[model samples]
Target chain A: MIRRQPPALVRRAAGPVLYRLARLAGGPPPGLRRGRDFAPADLPTVVVVVAGADEGSCAEVLDAVSRAQWASDAFTPVFVVDAPVLSPFRRAGYVVELAGPGGLGAAVAEARRSYAADLVVVAGGRGPEAADALTGLLLAQRPPIEGPVGRSRRFLRAAEARLR
Target chain B: MSGAGPEVGRGAPPADDVDVLRVLAPDEDAAVVAEELSLVAETGSRGAVLASSPGLPEEVLALVRRGVTRVLRPGEPVRAGAVVVGTPRPEHDLLAAVESPVVLGRAELPAGAAALLRALDGRLPGGRGNGPEGPDPVGPGPVAAGSSGRRRVLLVSSNGSGLGHLTRLVAMGRRASAGTDVHVLSMSSAVPLAAEGLLPYEYVPSAGDLGISARRWNVLLHRRLGEAVRRFRPDVLVFDGTYPYRAVAELGDRFPGVRLVWSRRPMWKPRMGAVQLGLVPRFDLVLEPGELAADLDRGLTVGRGDALPVRPITLLDQHELVGAAQARTALGLEQDVPTALVTLGAGAWHDVDSQLGAVVAGLRRVTPDAQICLVRPSIARSGADPGHGVRTVSAYPLSRYLRAFDVVVTAAGYNTFHEAVAFGRASGFVGVTAQLDDQPQRARWAQREGVGVDLDPLDPSSVARVAELLVDERARERCTARCAQVWPGNGAAEAMAAVEAVADGASGRELLGRAGASEGRGGREREASR
Candidate 1:
């Protein structure tokens, strides 16, 4: 025999109960996540890093990196991506690499060691939880990356003179 | 030089069997013919003497021999391959002797003679077919029997302050060339007509050098004009404006056959001294455009017709206006704004400044939204401010800019006034110079016909009145329509016909007789007296 459930009781039980479960479990949604970031210091050379889970996620990472490189000053870009994302970056003419699953912290450190990097940038997160965690870790280490704030102001001044 | 009739050795070669030869003489026609004949003979060719007559004066014969190769008398037989040369009279026996040969005459030769000459010279008849022998039929020798020849007219204009008279005469000369040649002998710069290819001209000493002023220059010019008249020997002589009266007198005496004409477009009282009037009768004809014929004294008036506009209104093409637009755009004007053109014909020592001020004020009031282009004779003296909706340009080619205007406000210089009328635009006339005797009359006439409005420069109210009228759409339309009826821009054709009639010695007497008959008419008489 099938037992009939009361709708009002079910609705009341679901919200608070799920919230407590998720706080303990700490897992993200099932969709693949992808991200990338770039900074160009030498006008003709750019640097990029990307992270993703699946092929589609890796493709998204590469596309984002390529667009950033094209928009920046004309440059040969160096890319560090998740192992699965490297093939697409390589096809796109970037000096590329396979990053292990620990995300871009090690990649940023390696880029600084291997190439005399003028800037360092980070991008992509599985979700808000993972993004928040990665940002917190990056803040603690403070990689030797030159930020875009001062450079953006200088570019703006040059652009303004050209317009006049 | 190969084929010949009876061989006559040189040393004033006998006029028996030769076609023609050049010799020096005072007679220019004979000299011209001799020169042409010499050119043909120097080419080393034999030509037939198709016709000869003792009636050709010895002076003319002597002139012809200087260039002619082999001139043949009436009964002389021409060689088989000779170029037959002679007059057009069919009775000449030498024409029958040659199978086909080149011929000579004062006018173009008859088509039949040209055909015959071309055939005998081993050239195709009609100058189009192939020849079995001799050179290809490049063209028929100048068929001189009936060809319409050029009748050269010389126009002498003074370098006076205004170009009104000179401009009008230039138009007349251009029109006169329909069946004749025209050469202008200007004392001033030979206007832009040369660049336009309208008339060929040369410059003489300035009118000032001809003693036109209160000084001794008039006497010097009188003598110089006489010398020029003797030198140019025109078929017809035209004196534009005044100060060439003594020259006209001298031309009458020196060149008795030449028809001496004067083109007068003055609107003011004659400032010419009393002695000047005595010389007026010597002119063979005085051509005045429009009702001006009525003003000329009896017998002096030879032709009366619509005067040709001094500026070519219809001739100002779209390209000229487009160029002006581009220029104005470069000078920083909004290309879309309605433009108004204001001009005062080269101002004399009159109330030019005051007149210009009134026009500026009126233009500002009427065209608050429009750009005003003031074409000043002297931009420095006019002192118009750019802030008052006015831009002063020194001497714009007015006809080119006239097309850019919805309306033109100007003084009654012959050229400016007619340009407005010809282009079918609304105009306002500000009478500034009493020296231009025609201005007041033209202005009144234009007003009556509703083609233009006349503002009295002396009256402040008149300026305001014109300013108010400028904004009236109906008034502008009415004026433009009326102008079309009065001056349809064919005055040049009429003037040409009148000139042709006079030059042909046909219509001149009738025109003069009509003028004499109309003497009793009080209206024209009154205008003349004024």
Candidate 2:
């Protein structure tokens, strides 16, 4: 039970690839798995980690969240950021929190606690196309257990469980 | 629930009402624009979009003043269910091209538009401009000044560990236009403005003081600031703080009609340089109080064109200080003995104990009978006792009694540096390590200018250097001469004039032009000095 966590760079690099794999292997509808045929009155929230130094990449990730096919309120995005976010994101109604010295994981944890979010997502990609490619995967996620469990890990865990 | 389902719109659809409304009408009449904006406000629309066009800057300003939170640009993409308003002309092509439903916008809220708004309103949670907990009934613009014909200015200062922000605001308020009714609204516990003759004070505890989350604190700030805006009906609200809170930025949209000015000082740490720069546009005016070491400034506010740069704002004018003998007598110090004041600020941290000991020990080595006064800043929670003989004095507006000390030992903060140099006091500067302030840079600048000696706290030899500087008559004379030569005139009067002008609706360009003139003169002086 002593699995080592991957380095942040490796996790970041693997994010989009994992998103595609998860989407291609879609399971039951996210709502049905939660035992509700109808949409929940209150949407679950997600702490999206907009980390790293690239502003454009961060914007693309946010764009992906905005374009996510779920209801406009499908999941409220509380951005845990390590980079400078443009004012437009704020105007777009995204709540942004600056990541502290503990880096992206700490920021995600703090954001989740502050916002009472059910899940976390690492919003990183090579470009706008990658962001677009991951939109469906972002919406089709269920709540993971506690701690800074990002989308890549959640997908990999589900895949591992299926193999078992 | 499965996250993937039939396309039933993004997120669960709200009961009714639109999330945002987009209007793309160019060259519309002023009355029509006003009515449309009013309807936007009345419905508490979360955001609005207007067709950007020529002669629309004022319309944009008016819309902002009417309390519309987010106004999208023509090409900026919005989520589904946003109702677009305007005929599909060449100018409106981009906005109309969006997939959302389009409807013709009228001066009056049309039944079709109302229904569309209802549909969008329920689409997003908390889709209200002035929320339920927010102050009700958005009122008219700048009410009359009660027969005085003078405008009212509400000066708000953040809860800084020192009185730097509060002092700057007090300086400006005291010098406001003769009949202008000025009120002080602050979150700082230090409200000694009454001593400076500026009355009508309101105090609100900061998030730290209340031990509340930032979200809750923002809500509290919104409620309190809203209440103040309603009560004071200030023509301009000038916030003196490092970080302009979300509530402060939302003032234009929340209360409407009140002009917002941020009175920020420079000399921030390099790490804190650009994180908050984006919030600059939120203010109608960003008034930067100039620093003495402007040329040597390495902080974030350097070379910024958006802010109007004024000369260093000090709490008291040079002439306001009492003569040395009278100042000494006022502070209960012996008139004949050599005296030095230590104002390193907030003795609770930064190894102030060692710094204080070094300075006191150094001054005592030169003149055993030297009188030393330590200025305990009003905000310090607790401080290390400076042992037996060092006199601990707490004074608000300490600038008024600067002449009490023959030599001054202090931190290189904005207010203290300007006052020490302006008063031509022989001084020694110590740079405290602060997250937001570049104190070492300031201390070095004073040393470079030959106005003061920079003392290094970690260097044990600094003790002897302080003693040498204190006792060296030639060094004292050099400091006095250099201070007199380098001192810039007080900018409080000019800053107040700019604040009042901004209150009367002066554009940032106009004020910046004046700042440019000052900067130009300073540049000329630098060239002349070379």
TM-score top scorer: 2
**Candidate 2 has what TM-score?**
0.55
**Model 2: per-residue Cα lDDT over B1-530, one tens digit each:** 11221112123333323344556456444454455545555666555655656345565567776566346566665543344333323333554333332122222232243433343334223312111122223332444333456788999998723477888888888898776888887776455333224566655546544333344456546765765787677888999988899989878876557888999888888758475778898888999887888777777888678888787888788778888788777766677766678776543322436766667766666667666777755433324446545665655566788877778888887778888898888888888887687888888988888888788653546655655665677887788889888877888888888989987779878888877897799899999989
Give stretches of model 2 more than 4 Å off: A1-164, B1-148, B193-196, B346-353, B376-388, B517-530
Superposition error at B210 for model 2 (Å): 1.2
DockQ of each: 0.00, 0.03
- Chain A, candidate 1, TM-score of 0.41
CAPRI docking class of candidate 2: incorrect
lDDT of 2 by residue, A1-164 (tens): 98566666766566445534533332211211111122322244555655453657665766677776243445555565665342334344345555433344444433433334433444443465556444644555333333443454345534432222
* Top-scoring candidate (DockQ): 2
Q: Which of the CAPRI classes, incorrect, acceptable, medium or high, describes model 1?
A: incorrect
Highest lDDT model number: 2
Q: What is the lDDT of residue B47 in candidate 1?
A: 41
Cα distance off (Å), candidate 2, residue B365: 3.9
